[model samples]
Target: MSLPPPALRALQGLGAVWTAPNTLIGVLGGLAGMLAGARPYWSRRDCALVFREYPWGPGGAITLGNVILHTGASLEIPCRTYAHQAGHCTEPVIGLHDHERAHVYQYLVLGPFYLPVYLLCGGVSARNPFERAADLYALHGHGWWPLKKR
Candidate 1:
């Protein structure tokens, strides 16, 4: 896996630390994504340890805030049809790539705090400027979710 740019790395690191309060939760959420994604490679990678966060009861559902999966998000979602954050993400649909990629930049720019800001901004249903930009950044036609669509 190639690493992000130095500046982005630094920013994300800082965001992780600064937002440690919430990032702790995010870490747990992200861990879920990682685990599911690693399933096919776990034994091969010699991966050890099980990471799961059952917030409610023994039969409680997984809790993956912004971490979108193929089936759905961590919560009780019907069908999230969008690829999003953390370690693993479902493949992007026709219009969700640029939207989610812009969110990755938000993580770089704001780090952990992005989560709260996202929440305050209404999350998936948000109409905030940041969310708007991400949602519309590359709705036309795109490849990599860079500033300029390819």
Candidate 2:
């Protein structure tokens, strides 16, 4: 059976608490990015903090807990046009935000273990189960957990 609203909320609160350490790391990174001319905003849709024009990392974006640091003007795929060109994104137009939100959910579930497990799984590569799961979640809106059997 499904949990009631209060129970669900309590569990969510507990999750936030569990993930607070990772969130602190994200906040620190976001603060550093902010000092480098990045803009921070809250995405209610993704339920996470997003930093645009982030000046660090290789490029693209990175997700730490509930924070997403993007090196673009927006989290949308095209970042400019609303045109739905083929090969740009999935059917529902999921983008980096959706992918990063999956990481946030992962952090909520795994807490402090998320980073160690992610690195052990292969950092950031197609072979990484976590990245694959995040990609799956972005495309299909589910399957956020890595190594989860079908």
- Who wins the TM-score comparison? 2
Worst 10 residues of 1 by lDDT: 39-48
Per residue, candidate 1 scores C-alpha lDDT tens digits across 24-109 of 56446545556555211111111111222323233312212223222222222222332343223453433333344445455545
The candidate 2 region of ten consecutive residues with least summed lDDT is 78-87
Q: Using Cα atoms with residue i matched to residue i, what is each candidate's TM-score against the true structure?
A: 0.41, 0.82
lDDT of 2: 0.78
Which residue runs does candidate 2 get wrong by more than 4 Å? 1-7, 78-94
- What would the per-residue lDDT of candidate 2 be over residues 1-150, giving only the tens digit for each residue? 578989976876787789888888888999998998999999877767898999987777887877788888898772211122324443444577777888888888998999999999888776678877877788777887877774
Which residue pairs show backbone clashes in model 1? Answer: 64-74
Q: Kindly report which residue stretches of model 1 are placed more than 4 angstroms away from their true locations once superposed.
A: 1-24, 33-93, 140-150
Provide the clash count, candidate 1: 1
